[model samples]
Target: MSTVIKIENLGKQYRLGQIGTGTVSHDLNRWWAKIRGKEDPFLKIGEANDRTTKGNSEYVWALKNIDFTVNQGDVLGIIGRNGAGKSTLLKILSRTTLPTIGSLKVKGRIASLLEVGTGFHPELSGRDNIFQNGALLGMTKKEITKKFDEIVDFSGVERYIDTPVKRYSSGMYVRLAFAVAAHLESEILIVDEVLAVGDAEFQKKCLGKMKDVSNKEGRTVLFVSHNMGAIKNLCTKGLLLENGETKIYGEIDDVINQYFKKSDAAEGYFTSAKLDKSEVVFIRSIRLSNQTGRATEIFNTGDDLIVDLELESDEDISKPNIAVGIKSKNGFITIGNTMLDGNQMPDLKKGLNKLSITFRSIPLLPQEYFLGIGMRSYDCKTFLMTTKEIGYFNISTRMVDLGITKPMAEEIAMDSVSPFIPYEWDFGNGNIQSFNILNNVIK
Candidate 1:
């Protein structure tokens, strides 16, 4: 396969402080120098950030000496934490942003959906905007007309296709924007975390369309998303970036492992909490344990989870209320039953207390998870304290199930009422017995 995208020692630098503050004079000087065939006026700069302090530096490199090649028909996944230069790379590929250093080469026309309203004309009607975006992507008016109805239907905005996009809901805007980008023809597709919006059905449809576009049409796609699930499903290869540098490139799993190694906290917790009212109240630590009753980073499908909340309150009130929450990696908070209510007989006094909350069955499928906890007064109306991202845990399980975690099962003794078996008995006497499989099986 030919190299569709080649990035050679690519580097992008951003000056510290507000942009445009001191840029007008520099811009004018550079423009005149370029017109007069002279070197850039402000090319000399000291080495980047002092690494001593975490404070912002006068200059920073968003990408540094990056080199990679994407082959034709390759669906490459770019994974990185926020500000890791993933978007910078995508923007360079799409020509939205120019690299400050090095060079990049592309072999095909690219359509980028880097942001929610990117390439959209808010003043124009949705229908007109479709043609505008298509034309910008090198599609002729006739080609857009040929695919107009399909785009409208796919976007589910046929009724409002003539309305100005400014009036459309965020969902509606995303739907139409994504529809145009995904459906219209292009040699290369560049998407960056735009699928994080829209409903589940729309996300699924977009994923399906992306798969079809690459597999059937053999288009080269460069995708950047924080959603590991989507990345795993849509991309055949993964590229991990950290602090504007490529940490791992090639296989998806290898990239993901390297990404975790870099991003995970030192304590292996999703979050750390330091109570503000330290004089009166404080929370030292918290964690979720797996079935083996050990502090583990991985879990199985049917493991019983124990959430341990270790607290050190200077002086616990007469009645203290507390609740623990488990948030999915996608930010869905799964609220579990709490013991802080007056209905529970337990009394939480002063000093350090080790509270263990247990759940027989965990509903969440195998994935990274986050934890949140809260404390309140017994009145159930007064808020005492709350902690977010208390910790992070990994529930590592195979692809056995999709949505729900549990599957019902039953066992029977050899002599117990004949094991239920659903069957139709044909008797010559003209009488027959018929029963449901579950009913008979449990008989």
Candidate 2:
């Protein structure tokens, strides 16, 4: 297949502090020099983006020396933790932004769904917006007319087709917007995490549509999702981006494995120190270990997962609701086990409590996963006290799994041992009655 997208040592840099100052003048000068057929100005090469003691006088390198290529009919999965420059890379690919150090080459029309309601005009009716987007995508009015009803039906917003998009709910807007982009028949489709906001069933349908768009239509797709399951099911290749560089680029399975390993090594899960807390309670810390109580970050499928949690209680409370959630490296929340989901446990004592959650065998596949811890008053209807993305770990092994919940299963043996030699039994009604005698000497 032909290459549809190509990046050569792509790098994007942002200055520290604020934009628009003497820097604007310098950028203008560079633009004028380029227009005048003079050598580039900023190509003089200054310090890098590191401000450590005696370090390069710098701002920040949002992306650095990134290079990758996508072929036609390929569904490429992009995976990374937050602030991993995934969105920055997408912006560059979609031409929404420019690279500071490198360049990109594209060979076809690109339809991007980087954000919800990306290209829709809020003031326009859903029907009008569809036509407008189609036009922008180079589709003729007759072409859009042929597919108009199909798009409306797939979006499930036929009732609101004539209503202005600004009056539509977020889900409704996304459904219609995605419909227009997906059905417009663009050669290269770039989708980000916008599909997450849709309802479960719609999300499933969107994933299926994306699969069809790539496999059946033979179009190239660049999908960035936090849902590991979707990526595993849809993508044949994967690209792992970290610090604005491609860390691993190969088959989907291997790329996902490397991304998970690196994720487990990240120090903290939250971007801010002031985590989400409430008057009821708060989470102090979360840790993981194995059976022998050794602090291990790497685990195997079916291996025991010991989660230790430390929490603080604001006041004296009884029967506090405690819950632990397990999310895959890509943000697909698989298991959310809560004490409230099961029989009520003992009331949490005062002040502080050390809770130990044990999973006899983690049913997840080999990959990086996160644990989100939450707490609340048992009687309180909602789980008010919660800390998200509290901890991270990695699981790896060569094991075929069935379901998410790996409950213990067993089988019992019966004492009927027979082969060529056989025995016979008789049934009687109060009186001893024999039905057969050695099968009548084999008749």
Candidate 3:
């Protein structure tokens, strides 16, 4: 295998709240600066890509000085928060956009399925779009004809093959687009979160196809998605981008662990402006604590765990129930307790209230999970306030003997149903039982 894709000093700059030189003076200034062998004057005025802040500069770098490589037959998973320049980098790689600085070298035909109906014309039928996409990949008519059936069959959209893509639902669009990209003999495949539009069954099929392309066909893939499970599954390497900068690179598992280690608040306190709130009832505070009642974001599997919450209501509340739970990386509830889930709960007093739920032993397998909290009326129909994911925590099942601390996301069980460790066993020189199957007899 060779270095098929290499990028050096790649960067992308954008002007916030404006497109293409908001004013003629600014554009002239930039050009003048460049002609004088100087940096763009606007480049000196941009703020970091932090989404929460009110940016001070009109210019921002969606991506800056990113340098990495993708070798032949490598599946590199790129992950980060929204606005981390994931889409921008892919656009540059796919030739849909040009980087403001640096260069990219590509050695193979690239097939990119970026967004819903990304490459397809809304007026073109699915069948026609197949050929269109192939052409975009530099494929000839004969070659596309050869792979046409496989693409259509894989997409499972033959019934609507002749229908204009504009009529296709989001799911159907992604299925057809992905199918075309996967089977059209392209050497490099770049996929975004388009598969998120498909059903679970289809998502599974796409993942399998990606694996086959990389493992069997010896192709390269650049994938970006928030689905960490999928990232861990099909990728041998990972690249984590933070605020438009390269944070970590290399082995998939280590990169993911770095993400968690850098992301979650280990002190067990999480406060976000994105939490769901309303005037009726809203979250005042959310935290996680261990056995000692000290704030912590990391806990051992099968050990005591605690969740504390402070909520507020503007008006007198009646029959309000509180709920707390841990959500997996996939956004599913691993386990939780609710006041409305057959538990008698007290009414929340106006202004402020505090509650804590304690678990004798955390049953979760070794993994990292999100903290979820909600406040609602007892009837469950009245939505007072809720925060789907306000904080993050990790369950450490460090095997002292093996010195294992971090387990990959996919290796952990879905539900924390069983305690994975901390059990006792003893074997004395007492009589032992043995069985032999060769002679169909037990001895």
Candidate 4:
């Protein structure tokens, strides 16, 4: 397949605090330089886009020396942290903004859904907006008419097709916007995180449509999202940007793995003071330990996860709601626990406190998992402290526990078995009956 889009040395620069020259004289100097076929003086002093650092220059590069190519019918996923220049790159690709440097080559009509209601005129009716977007994508009236019904039906807004979009809710606007962009017959499609505003069902529909567009219609796509699952599912290739610079570009799985390695959980330990902030109650430290009681980031199936929590408080907190949430490396919240729920929660005294939470024979399949801890008032109205993805541990596949009667590889999950819970089964009335299947394992 041919390259549908190519960017070489692509760069975009912006002023830090002021817009369009601090003074008229400077603006004239820039115009004179532009007219004389000379480089703009401001370009020489632009700083790199490292958000963590303070720089002296008034200009910063939103994107610098970005080079990549997207093949025809390829779906490329772009990912990065906030202010990492993801939106800026998309804006440049969508022609909504001009890059201060470098060249961008395009091979087809590009339809972009960068933001909610990006191409729509709010005063116009949904029906009119659909036709307008189609027209902008170079579709003739006849061609747009042919797809009009499909677009309206897909948007699930047929009842309000003639209603002015100004009154549409954000979700409705996203649905209509996505439907038009997907059906407008554009050869290339670009979608930003704006799709996240849509409901789960609508997002599923949009993903399916993008798949159809790429596979059935042979169109190219550029998808930008923070949802690693979505990116892994929809994209065949990936591009990772940090500080407005391309860090990795290749197959999606490798790219996602690289992403996991860069995440906070990958550190296996979160020690920063940012984890807790409440004076009523605060966590002093949180860490993970394996069965041997030694701090370990790697775990085998059927190993105990010992979570040690040390906390402090300025005032006595009675019956504080304490919990720990375990999330998979893929960002799935696998299991969460509270102070045994509906039971007598121990009163937390002022000053230092210590506790250990243990998950016997961790049942999660071979993968990485992170921790999210929280504490709140007994009434659940005030949060003392809460943290997410504070630390992570890895689970490697291991043989079944030494005494297990039967074990299946596929049975592994957040809860494969409960050794701590006691239960009784009775064959009553020729039917099996259970007593307290979820009876307390930890007491």
Model 1 — which ten-residue stretch has the worst lDDT?
A: 407-416
Q: Output the better candidate (2/3) by TM-score.
A: 3
Query: Which residue pairs overlap in candidate 4's backbone?
Result: none
Residue-level error in angstroms, candidate 1, position 244: 2.2
Model 1 lDDT per residue over 163-275, tens place: 99989888888888888888768889988778778886787778888888889999988888876666766788999887788888898866765665524454333333454
Clashing pairs in model 1, backbone N/Cα/C closer than 3 A? 269-392, 270-391, 270-392, 420-440, 420-441, 421-440
TM-score of each: 0.73, 0.66, 0.74, 0.72
For candidate 4, write residues 138-252 as lDDT tens digits. Answer: 7898998998999899999999899999999999999988887888778899988776687767877888888899999999999998766567667999998888888899998
Quote model 3's TM-score.
Answer: 0.74
Q: For each candidate in the order shown, give its overall lDDT on alpha carbons.
A: 0.69, 0.69, 0.74, 0.74
By TM-score, who's the top model here? 3
Provide C-alpha RMSD values for all models, in order.
Answer: 12.0, 14.4, 9.9, 8.9
Model 4 earns a TM-score of 0.72
Candidate 2 lDDT, tens digit per residue, 1-443? 89988889988876656666788787898899999999766554444332333435335676787888889999999988777788888888888799888889999899886366767898999999899887876778998999999999999999989998999999998888788779977899988988778887787678889989999999999999876656766799999887656789999988867765533344322222326544556666666677677666667666667666666666667766666666653453444344423434355655665666665555555545677766656765766575466667766443234333321110000011111111111111222222222355675
Candidate 4 lowest-lDDT run of ten:
420-429
Give the TM-score comparing model 1 with the true structure, all chains together: 0.73
**Which residue ranges in model 3 land beyond 4 Å of their true spot?**
20-22, 166-169, 262-267, 271-286, 289-304, 308-322, 327-356, 360-369, 374-389, 394-443
